[model samples]
Target chain A: MKALEQKILTDGIVLSDTILKVDTFLNHQMDPLLMKQIGEEFAARFQHKEITKVLTIESSGIAPAIMAALQLEVPMIFARKRKSLTLQDGLLTSNVYSFTKQEETEISVAKKFLTEDDHILIIDDFLANGQAALGLLHIVEQAGATAAGIGIVIEKAFQDGGERLRERGIQVESLARIESLQDGKVQFVKETRRVEV
Target chain B: MKALEQKILTDGIVLSDTILKVDTFLNHQMDPLLMKQIGEEFAARFQHKEITKVLTIESSGIAPAIMAALQLEVPMIFARKRKSLTLQDGLLTSNVYSFTKQEETEISVAKKFLTEDDHILIIDDFLANGQAALGLLHIVEQAGATAAGIGIVIEKAFQDGGERLRERGIQVESLARIESLQDGKVQFVKETRRVEV
Candidate 1:
């Protein structure tokens, strides 16, 4: 994850102590080559789980998840976000509260896409409070599918989301983990050197 | 485009005369291999344009756009959709009306991502009413960027979007052009066999 960490240092904008904007090459505008590499890295890391599908939230997660799915030779499914729930049938739904947006949104996936036979790898762009990952995990559980692991591009380690999932014994792998973003500087965790760049 | 056409006939659900649900592989639950093929197809079609960037709207458009960008070795930018505009500066914004959802959503891109020297290839999942394409074209124009061409996965030729763009002398390449969707059957435009699968 050295390239990603380096890109964050070079292009990432520190909007505030709690907000890091990587619109240049991560989310709003993206680098397809970097995304492909990120996907390869995720696939390499989770290749042992025998993943049948890649699951992620809409918009941001689709890029890496699609690429990883391609590398893993599996299907990729993005859970759709809805502002209002209409009580649809044959849909697995979960509620997520975004601390950044300060709003509650419902995420859903078609039940036919997931089954007891599938092992899913959940992927996302940012893991701050881990609400989005939790919501995706909930949908995966509802379908009777096994969550192989969670792949995150960037994780705010100062927050409790990553720790919460780890506490549940869920395998969480974040490519870039931020130790702190205080004083307009991004501080990555120094001790964990096992993750490849 | 035979593979795409065949996939549409096999997995695509023709909901009505105007709506075709391709969530099985094109949007919601996507096949990565098919999507990779789609990206390659788009890249081949627009290879002669010297495209500096690939552009598209968020969510559905990201998959194809990213793949095309990867093949083309360029950056991809997805316009962010906003239900309510916050009047932000340094953004190229346009209004797009979704005929399916029957709502007006403002789409915007960061000003720095696009430039006058850039030759952009606009990619999208569908070309139904062409409102989304029009909005993207407007943003390109605002940035003083030249649009090399527009690449669409499926074009509802029964609709007026394709005609409108062609009327403006824009080079539009649609992988699958539908002649009709009558009696719950998907009918592709028969004459244009120039597009390779």
Candidate 2:
């Protein structure tokens, strides 16, 4: 976790007061060693939940989520994002709104992958406004599965997404929690509090 | 590699004569153990290339590519796909046509991540028409980098993609080479040949 926070500070770019770009390492171009470490941290944190599946959105979340799934010795399922509303049967679908792109995209997973007997662990790269996490949670509910916990690589704590999930009694664990990106300076949360679900 | 071949025969669904759906273990719902094995296999095959980086497209390719990168102890960069032509500066972009989806999408990588000194290993889940690999090779060329080789999880040898790449003297190592999908049965290539590039 410290390595991730340090990497974020050293390589992450702060474009504005609210926007942080981690294309150098985390999302676009990835450091596999760091991703492996992240996976280990997530696995160690939520090892008690008895997670059966690791769920994440496609593209950005695949690297970290897959690594975590490998560490957890479970399967990783990534929800495919579709711009057009081509709804298909036997698929669990949810719409997620991206604040940066300012567009609504539908994320879907096959129904056969999830069942009531499964325990799901949701993972993502960034937890801003919690739209993606919420959408995944909705799909998990649709499958009649149990939500074990949510693991995030980076959380914009200044935003209300983390708070919202915690309000719903969800265990949200983030490696690096950004308190603020004000004035082009990166500020991290001084302390992390765990919410027992 | 034998494990991968067995998995395909057991779980891979032949949706049609031209399409094989591997969502059960390769793409949508991923088996991390198999993915790790795949990573080890790719790393072993391309280990002599002195690969400085591992590259792939977004979503499906991320899992295997990152695993290979981890095994190789290098960085992994996934090209971002864009439907709209944003045309951002400081980015290497290439257009890839998806035969399955019947659409053309632009895949972009940050120019800073790739350099002339880097030896890249391109990894992907499938090598069908090789449009994605071609696009990635173009990006690597634009960056003045050397493409050591390509590691494909499954190669549709019946298609011209693998042939086209091999014709150009590119080293393409595919774990499973499917010769045909006739009558909903998967037929693998009788013998595998290594093209010395």
Q: Considering every candidate listed, which one attains the maximal lDDT?
A: 2
Off by over 4 Å in 2: A83-88, A192-197, B83-87, B192-197
Clashing pairs in 1: A1-A196, A1-A197, B1-B196, B1-B197
Clashes of 2: 0
Each candidate's DockQ: 0.61, 0.63
The sequence of per-residue lDDT tens digits that candidate 2 reaches over residues B92-193 is 999999987779998999898999999999999999999999999999999999999999999998899998888878789999999999999999888755
Report per-prediction Cα RMSD to one decimal. 2.8, 2.0
lDDT at A51 for candidate 2?
97
Candidate 1, position A101, lDDT: 67
Give me the displacement of residue A12 in model 1, in angstroms: 0.9
lDDT to native, each model? 0.90, 0.90
